[model samples]
Target chain A: MTEEARRSPERAKRLPRAVREKQILDAAVQVFSRHGYHSASMDEVSEVAGVSKPMIYSYLGAKEDLFIHCIRREANRLLAAVEAGIKPDLAPDMQLWHGLRSFYAFVAEYRESWTVLHRQAMSVGGPFADEVNAMRERAIELVAALVVSAGARRGLAEQAESSGEGMAAALVGAAESLADWWLDHSDVPDGVLASWLMNLVWLGFNDLVEGAVWKPAE
Target chain B: MTEEARRSPERAKRLPRAVREKQILDAAVQVFSRHGYHSASMDEVSEVAGVSKPMIYSYLGAKEDLFIHCIRREANRLLAAVEAGIKPDLAPDMQLWHGLRSFYAFVAEYRESWTVLHRQAMSVGGPFADEVNAMRERAIELVAALVVSAGARRGLAEQAESSGEGMAAALVGAAESLADWWLDHSDVPDGVLASWLMNLVWLGFNDLVEGAVWKPAE
Candidate 1:
């Protein structure tokens, strides 16, 4: 063995807790996204990370712990991206547009993270499902707040027929499904995709806040 | 074993091929929904269905084939439900509302089927993903056609800026997500849940066709 290897054989050089944790989490995300929660193994995560299994355990606790960490990190990164994209000073519609655009862009850039959070983590269906569901609720609430507050500013919040919670749930669902569709149709610009949703949802939402209803013309 | 059990050694009677296949698919859906696609096993499916593994194989092919079959059956059932709900003679808005009600009712009745088709199948992410995605595309097309033809009846089809495909993707996503939310909030009636989506999407959609653009108030 080389002198340095002989001196310290565990790692090239021991990384700080934060850097090592990041590397392990990054590798964990890749492995989890590919193999899914139950199918994924700690050995695979370690091999992918180029770190040893014991180190992974010491650093991330266990398989479940590592998976949860990946979910929380990616979820926050996503929420943070949308939050950063929204400028409170901008008009509400503009703010919503920016949030949507930021959402699409984030999914594009972090496809693995998005897949892990949106697809794999939720698939396991246990405590992890609840964890991811909480994240989902937060996301829905953020968008719903945007929709309702925009209406509230116009003094039309109480007059609306639909509840903000339900509308926000639909809006988040639309954006999410569109994002998944965007994975295939990557040629479409994020702005256009976001605008399509804006027209499909916000226009109807604005009218509803103004108390307009579409009925069958008998 | 009782005399009847000793005589047959398994199963109560020699059911026909079609009846046997239905039994297998029903069991497969239950097992897949409870344990998810990857964790679910042929043995468990056999136990659940009261059929031998060979019978499952002969009847359904393999695990993947079984999953595809379950997804296909459920997707067709859902699409059929919506189709049955729509009457061509009805006004566009009413037809859409009927379709929405049908969707919610289907989910409420066959939630396990919906869980397998909507959540578990897509989560598996392989040939099954393609199969489910094609089903999703068909669903989106169905809804988009409804929205566009309604606009056509109003002579506002050509004037609209958004394509039916994009808008439909948003609408289907909203429904799928809202349905997921509905699973937790079962106290809400199917009609209310369906109406929430109708208002969230159709109302805005109606305004869009009428050339109402929601722009930031400058």
Candidate 2:
């Protein structure tokens, strides 16, 4: 056998199942992001991953299952990155600022992941859309908790509790929509995007908590 | 011939093509909203519209074409409602407030249309998703114009021009997202939902134009 052929088995043996699955998933995400779910192929994923088709199928099942895995993995990674970026010790606005910054940073660094998670998965629809929705619900809950806590600190816990989730849903949607917009307008850096959102959302949220409402000038 | 059958031709003649198409479209929207695109049947649409299947085919084409027509018609109606609600004589904030109130009112009045336009079309993906995106682009442009004008009135045209479209994208997204959230939390009145969004976004936007900014605590 050739030298590379002889080393292949050894490499496979050294890499555990989890490592191989990650390799397959990484390749799958790249391919899916580039071509989307309908047009993406298993062959490209295998070639990019340097794993055989059978091996990928064994690790992650077929293309549908593989796409799901990529979505779930990327969604978790995004949430984790934002969560890690938040400093609970800081004030609510500061915590949100950091979270937004981390979110944009993650999107900027992993454009492919964001593309697959936000664009590809959403357009593919069906169960894929469901997965993205579930992830969004989690993100909303996280923001709602922050809004409620901030309200409690201001002695407006009842008002905050009543409107916090809806407000969080709007904020999450704004962040998501801005990120999707950034996919086309990449010239704007991540920090600026995050800052723009902060100026657009946090200031208003601050006013709401501070009992300053904007009424129509009828 | 039976008395009813004798007058059928006269009735068909009296009802113009446009009216017939509207009847067919209304039924199609209801069916699509209830059963979704794939699971929905033309038979149900015909039954609901009181129009024969062959007549529907002649007027609106097959299931796919009929669905597209439904989406386009509803999108136009929605845009028209919001546009009509805005009074150019009013200030920008009041204009937007009126526009949002009109939007929620439309959603409340035609929950089925909103369901088909927002949830069903999006989940069906492909061309349907493209149609929704096009509608969204038009909305963003409308909001961007409002932002740019508001900025110009404040002598901050340059700042607004640079970020008007992006900010509008975020605002439009927040509105859409909140509407979706309102779908589940229907206890909140249409006025309350619109006011919540105004408090969540308009105040922040107002602050931005007035030269207020939120910065990191650090």
What is the per-candidate TM-score for chain B?
A: 0.91, 0.95
Runs off by more than 4 Å, candidate 2: A1-4, A7-14, B1-14
Please write out the lDDT profile of model 1 over residues A51-143, one tens digit for every residue. 888888988899988988999999899999999999998877788888988998898888889888877765565666667778879988897
Lowest lDDT block of 10, candidate 1 chain A? A158-167
Pick out the ten consecutive residues of candidate 2 chain A with the lowest summed lDDT: A5-14
Tens-digit lDDT string for candidate 2 (B42-94)? 99999999888999999999999998999999999999999999998889999
Candidate 1's error at B52, in angstroms?
8.2
**How far is A204's C-alpha from truth in model 1 (Å)?**
0.9
Q: Is the docking of candidate 2 incorrect, acceptable, medium or high quality?
A: high
Interface RMSD of each: 2.8, 0.7
Candidate 1: which pairs clash?
A: A204-B204
Across A51-92, the per-residue lDDT of candidate 2 in tens digits comes to 889888888899999999999999999999999999999999
Q: Please give the lDDT score for candidate 2.
A: 0.92
